[model samples]
Every structure is written in C-alpha cells, then in structure tokens.
Target: MPSLDPEEGDAIRQALGLDRAARPYRNHYPAPGDDPVAGRLVERGLMERGAATPAGLVLFQVTEAGARQVGARLPEAEAGR
Candidate 1:
C-alpha cells in the first residue's frame, strides 16, 4: 500500500486510540467532523463508518489495513499486539 499523507496518518492514529498522548479509551472509534481526509480514507478502504449514535454521530473505525499501517508506526510494546 502507498504511504499515507500526513493528515491521513493522523486520522488513522486518532481512530486507533494512539493519538492524544496515547490515552486509551473504551470507545476507540472516533467521529471526525466533516473531514475530507477521513472521507478519503473511507474511499481508500482504510477506514469504515459504523452505526450512528443516538445523537446522530457517525463513528469511524480503522480497517485491518489501517491498523496495520498504524501498527507499523508503533513500537511493539505500544502496539499491544
């Protein structure tokens, strides 16, 4: 796969619960607000949209490929796998 652009990389990181000082959360999926980069990632088959929340937020999850990309950037200990 081609390397991601910086914005794309950041989006994937955020979705994987690795951004923001690596503070893990129960809900790892993130709902980005009208981000073109996130849309591009969906188009590229790296990220996928999940069911909407009661508040109408569309959550985005990383695909296996997306996780692999982020995993490559993470240290083994930090990668948690």
Candidate 2:
C-alpha cells in the first residue's frame, strides 16, 4: 500500500472522527461531492464503502487497519487477539 501523506492522514482521521474525540468506529457519510480523498482511502484499504443511501450517497466506514493507522483503539475482541 502507498504511504499516507499528511493530507491523506488528516482525511482518514476526519473520516474516523478522530479529529473530534477518539471515535474510531464511527461511520461517516460525506457529501456526494466531498469524496475526493475517500476513493483514495478505499483504495489504500484503510476504509471501505458501505451500502448506498436512498439518495445514492455511499456510507464509509473505517477498517481495523485504518483505525490502527490513526492510533485508535480497536474493539475488545480484536484488541485481545
């Protein structure tokens, strides 16, 4: 995978809500036109695209690897492993 630059890292953090608190597992639904970095994130395997909304907007969720990249704690089960 490609290394994350400052912009990409910041984007991942924002998507995971790490910018606010430490919400590592929260899902983010960016505005339809606000997904330039999102595609790159998905390509990097840090985030995955979820189901589409009624209006056709896609849901984006952080993966375990993505959470770790941002220094966010994994769930108990995954963490224990």
Candidate 3:
C-alpha cells in the first residue's frame, strides 16, 4: 500500500462513500481544512482535484497508480464482499 496519511485518506474514504452510486465523481467533506493522506496522495500524483461546482461539490478520482494502491490495500472483509 502507498504511504498515505491515515487522516487524509480517511477523509477521502468518507467522501467516496457519499456518492449516489451513479455519479462519475463524489463530493468531499464540506470543508477542506487539511488532510495529510489526501495531501500526500495529491502531492504524489495519485489524486487530482476537479472543479467545485455551483452545487457545492468538489471532485476527485484515483489515478491508475492510486487505483492499484487502493486495490492492493483492500481489507479481506471488503474484498470478500
């Protein structure tokens, strides 16, 4: 797994979980105070920022490397499900 900062990664994880199941992107937590995991991922080119729309949303997607990183890090419980 990539060395993501837990706090930041957790935020991203939370954001990912909020999607409606059909959107290409999801919104982040309402605030962008600071998240080390998110910062490191973005800094390392694993995550990219997208525009914040008038609807109050920000978008993000996993890079190819990021997809691999997350895939590799899946917990056994989640993988089985």
Q: Could you give candidate 2's per-residue lDDT for residues 1-81 as a string of tens digits? A: 567778778866876667777555454645453587777778888877777778877777667777678677554543333
lDDT of 1 by residue, 1-81 (tens): 888999988888776567765643322355644668878888888877776778666777667677677663433343443
The lDDT of model 3 is: 0.48
C-alpha-based local distance difference test score of model 2: 0.68
Off by over 4 Å in 1: 20-29, 32-34, 72-81
| C-alpha TM-score for every candidate | 0.67, 0.66, 0.47
Give the worst 10-residue stretch by lDDT in candidate 3: 72-81
* Model 2 steric clash pairs: none
lDDT of each: 0.67, 0.68, 0.48
Arranged by TM-score with the best first, the candidates are 1, 2, 3
Per-residue lDDT, model 1, residue 36, is 85
